[model samples]
Target: MNATDRLTELFMRFPGIGPKQAKRFVYFLLREHFHFKEQLINALQELKHTGKQCERCYSFFGDKNLKNPKSKCHICLNENRDEKILMIVEKELDLDAIEKTGSYNGQYFILGGVLPPLTEKPSELIRVRELVARIYDDITNDSLEEIIFALPVTDYGDVTKEYLEKTLGQIVGMKNIKMSTLARGLSSGLELEYVDRDTFKSALERRQ
Candidate 1:
């Protein structure tokens, strides 16, 4: 493919970009401020270079202890926070959104991605098994009490949440797992960020 065609193809690979959107982006980059092309390239290159996933919570960032330091992520290391309640999120963006509210004092677990049936094996992409082990480890070792699920409202999100709840229930033997979901007052099909702050806080407070 030509260079323009190649860039269009690359842009299309992004989550919400369609062919037309990709073409517009490429044209804009080429025509509007060509200097930004270098910035884009540098940003993409630096993305991999800067951040490493936290060993404990799996949230990736450019923290000092990201590699092998004694301390974990700030949330994981915060002694004042309640480790007993864990909030599981689909993406780091959603985690950030919730964290901005400053309402939730509990720690978090990031699933990395929602579950999908694209794989032949059900266990392929989703890591509910490891998640379960983490929960059990926390309960027995760290004395955790509840798990709040903050997954999106998509089909994949719903399925993954159900799978986790069922698996944890089976493994822990009883609903000793006080599982909860984002409250329904928030729009049924909206992302966590689109909802207003008041509603988001309300949803968190009324989270079930």
Candidate 2:
């Protein structure tokens, strides 16, 4: 394939980008100024090196003066944020949406992805083991009290939540952690990343 075709193909790999949209992106980039392309390339190249994932919550942050290789993100390191409440989200975008609501002042764990039904060893698909470990660690060390499931309002989200509820319930001492999900303010099939802040806030407030 030529450069244009190869680039379009790569763009198509992005979530929700169809072949036509991907081609449009390629042509748009081709028409952009040389400096724009240079800047985009530079940013993409520096992304991995500049950003580091927090050891505690697994959220990525850009810290130029980071001293420790396993440093926590600002939210995890904050003294005021409630360590007892941990919210589990599917992706960083969902986390961003929740933060924008300004209703939740607690720690978060990004699952990286949602689990689909019939997937063998569902724990391997997302950060289930890591989340379990974190829950235990926080319960023992940080006085964890509750865990909120902030996944999208989709079939996969429900499946993942049910799996977590069942599995985590079996862990010793985890019974004390009050688990809840975002309320019905989120319509069926709605993703947390796309939900309005007001609706998200209402769901958060009504979470049981």
Candidate 3:
């Protein structure tokens, strides 16, 4: 493949860029004299080696933590947060959405992805096991009081939540686990990230 085709292939790998937009971006970079091209190349190269996943949250930050990883993130380490009240979310995006609301002061457990038979591998579900182990280890002989399910308000999200609640619920005990979900206000925002701060805040307040 030629340089233009090569650039198109690279850009297409990005989340939302289509062929037309990728071609336009490549041409723009070419006209701009390749500085952006060099920058993109350098960034991608660094990404291959750096920004490892945090062992605790599974969120990709930088490599320093990966070298000497911590069992908890800054939020998880915070003394003020309610360690007894845990919230399980499907992805980092959902976690960020709740954090932006400033409504929840509890610790978080991210599942990394939902359980969809299409792309959901059983190994990917190990994160849920990690959550169970962490709670058992951290809560001083498994005394966690609450676990809020904050997955997206989708049909798939509902199925995943029920599965988790059943599976982990058995290991952790259904009596100790009080399951709650975000309010309907979040439905208006569809994409959790796009929700306004107030909407998210209200959703948390109305959470049952």
What residue runs in model 1 are displaced by over 4 Å at the alpha carbon?
Answer: 64-72, 115-121, 154-156, 173-175
Best model number under TM-score: 2
Cα distance off (Å), candidate 2, residue 19: 3.6
For model 2, state the Cα shift of residue 117 in Å: 2.7
How many clashing pairs in candidate 1? 2
TM agreement with the true structure for every prediction: 0.78, 0.87, 0.77
Clashes of each: 2, 0, 0
Choose 1 or 2, whichever is better by TM-score.
2
Clashing pairs in 2: none
User: Per-candidate RMSD vs. true structure?
Assistant: 3.3, 2.3, 3.4
- Writing each residue's lDDT as its tens digit, candidate 2 over 1-208 gives 8999999999999999999999999999999999999999988877766788888788888776746665788898889998888899999998887787787899999998888987788877899899989888886785788889988777888899998888788653445778888787635555678777788778888899
Q: In candidate 2, where is summed lDDT lowest over 10 consecutive residues?
A: 169-178
Q: Estimate the lDDT of model 2.
A: 0.84
1-208: candidate 1 lDDT, tens digit per residue? 8999999999999999999999999888878666788888887777767666765677876654336655367778789998778888887888788788777899888877887634345465665666877877786675677888888888888878877776687655553667888786645675865556777778888887
Tens digits of per-residue lDDT for model 3, 129-183: 7876766665564546777777767777777877777667675664455667777
The stretch of ten residues in a row with the least summed lDDT in candidate 3 is 117-126
- For model 3, state the Cα shift of residue 170 in Å: 2.0
Please list the residue runs of candidate 3 whose C-alpha ends up more than 4 Å from where it truly belongs after superposition: 33-49, 63-72, 117-126, 140-143, 186-190
Greater-lDDT candidate between 1 and 2:
2
